[model samples]
Target: MDGATQFAVSALINILTSLICITLSWWVLQNVRLDLFLRNPGGIQGKMLQVLLSIVLGHGLAVFFIDYLGWSGMIGQLF
Candidate 1:
């Protein structure tokens, strides 16, 4: 594939991975008991906090996976 095509594919993969991870994180976070830490877990602020945490955690996880895949692919160069 050409450079542009490769770039597009990589971009698509990164976006999809980030979105999937974010969704997974959001779903998993629903089980956490935020009431223990928050005065009102059902309030808007609490919900915002959950969303922010989900994005941060999901992005971190996505970066890790993407980096791991890239590094593993590079292993072939060692031969």
Candidate 2:
């Protein structure tokens, strides 16, 4: 791909990765009540903890998907 095309592909992948991560986090919290482990489960602290957990887990999963599974290459091909 040309430089411009490659840039666009990279941007698109980043956006999609973020969206997927947020969606997965929301789904897990809503359906699984995974934030119950927090001390103040219904307070701001709990909410912040949940957000942090989601971000870390999301990034970790994204790295695994891109590096270990080579899904990044598959996604790049789609663009």
Candidate 3:
């Protein structure tokens, strides 16, 4: 494929991966007991915190996965 097509495909994969990871993180976070650390776990601030945490954690995971895939793909160059 051309450079533009490859770039577009990569962008789409990144977006989908990020979104999937974010959703997975949010789902996993639901099991945590936020009340232990927050005075109002049900309040807007608490919800916002949850969202932020999910995004951070998810993005971190996504980065790791992307980097791993890239590195693995380069392994054949060693031959």
Candidate 4:
């Protein structure tokens, strides 16, 4: 109930959210043009960078839209 406790809980939630976001992103990308991506069948090296980029970008985009859209939607909110 204290400041530290709240911070800890918030941090945990953020971590879980980011993890879920990354996983969701990877799954989506895997299905998208999967045949082309896996034409050579990346064993380990090829998939690693793609996975990392997907996670970082996925969480980043989510944060951007969530924090920015509410402000950007002011016109729609008026109508």
Candidate of highest lDDT: 1
Lowest-lDDT window of 10 residues in candidate 2? 64-73
| Tens-digit per-residue lDDT, 4-78, candidate 4 | 998798677667766777777887777665446554447675577578768887798667654564467676888
- Candidates in order, TM-scores: namely 0.97, 0.66, 0.96, 0.62
Identify the runs in model 1 with alpha carbons over 4 angstroms from their true place.
none
Rate residue 50 of model 1 by lDDT: 100
Error of 1 at 35 (Å): 0.4
Query: Which digits, one per residue and each the tens of the lDDT, describe model 1 over residues 32-69?
Result: 99999999999999999999999999999999999998
Ranking by TM-score: 1, 3, 2, 4
Arrange candidates by lDDT, highest first: which order?
1, 3, 2, 4
Q: How close is candidate 2 to the true structure, as a TM-score?
A: 0.66
Candidates 1 and 2 compared by TM-score, better number:
1
Over the stretch 1-79, how does candidate 3's per-residue lDDT look in tens digits? Answer: 9999999999999899999999999999999999999999999999999999999999999999988978997997889
On lDDT, the stronger of 1 and 2 is: 1
All candidates: CA RMSD in angstroms? 0.6, 4.7, 0.7, 5.2
* Alpha-carbon local distance difference test for all models: 0.96, 0.72, 0.95, 0.70
lDDT of 1 at 66: 92
